[model samples]
Target: MIIPKNIEELASYAEKGKNVFFFTADWCGDCSFIKPQMPEIEADFPQFNFIQVDRDQYIDVAAEWSIFGIPSFVVTNDGEELGRLVNKNRKTKEEISGFLKMVEG
Candidate 1:
């Protein structure tokens, strides 16, 4: 997963191929819990480019995307939104994989 330096960089990524913006915060327990499984998730879904967005560092971007959750996901392709799993709940690896499967379809 790559971390965008700014909102513009994130937009550029979204405008290209498949992109999954993972919104998270260092202080968030949920984010930390799922951090280790991110590589596996990315490997499982090779079609999508994962971009890590720090909620604290990119608050403006999160606000624009209406993401108030610590650990959330927004999938986009060619600048169009495909799906999102945005919420303030803890997510498991299976749940995340399931969401990606649905998005892939």
Candidate 2:
């Protein structure tokens, strides 16, 4: 997974191919809890490129995307939003997988 340094890199990722933007924050408990399980999710879904974006670092971007929750996952391709799994609560691996399935469908 690529950790985008700036908005330009983030845009480039979405503009090129299927990408999943993971919105998180360093202090978010839910984000930290799911961090360990991301590897398995990434391995299970190889078709989409996953990128982590720190909400604190990219406040403007997060705001523009209307991401008010930590550990939000937004799927996009060619700059168009395909689907999203966003909430203020903690997410399980199954829930994440289900969201991907919905997006893929």
Tens-place lDDT per residue, model 1, 3-101, is 988878877997888999899998999999999999999999999999999999888888999998879999999999999999999999999999999
Query: After best superposition, candidate 1 residue 52: deviation in angstroms?
Result: 0.0
Question: Model 1, residue 72: displacement in angstroms?
Answer: 0.1
Q: TM-score of model 2 relative to the true fold? A: 0.96
Backbone clashes in candidate 1 total: 0
The TM-scores of all predictions, comma-separated, are 0.96, 0.96
Tell me how candidate 2 scores on lDDT.
0.91
Candidate 1 residue spans exceeding 4 A from truth:
none
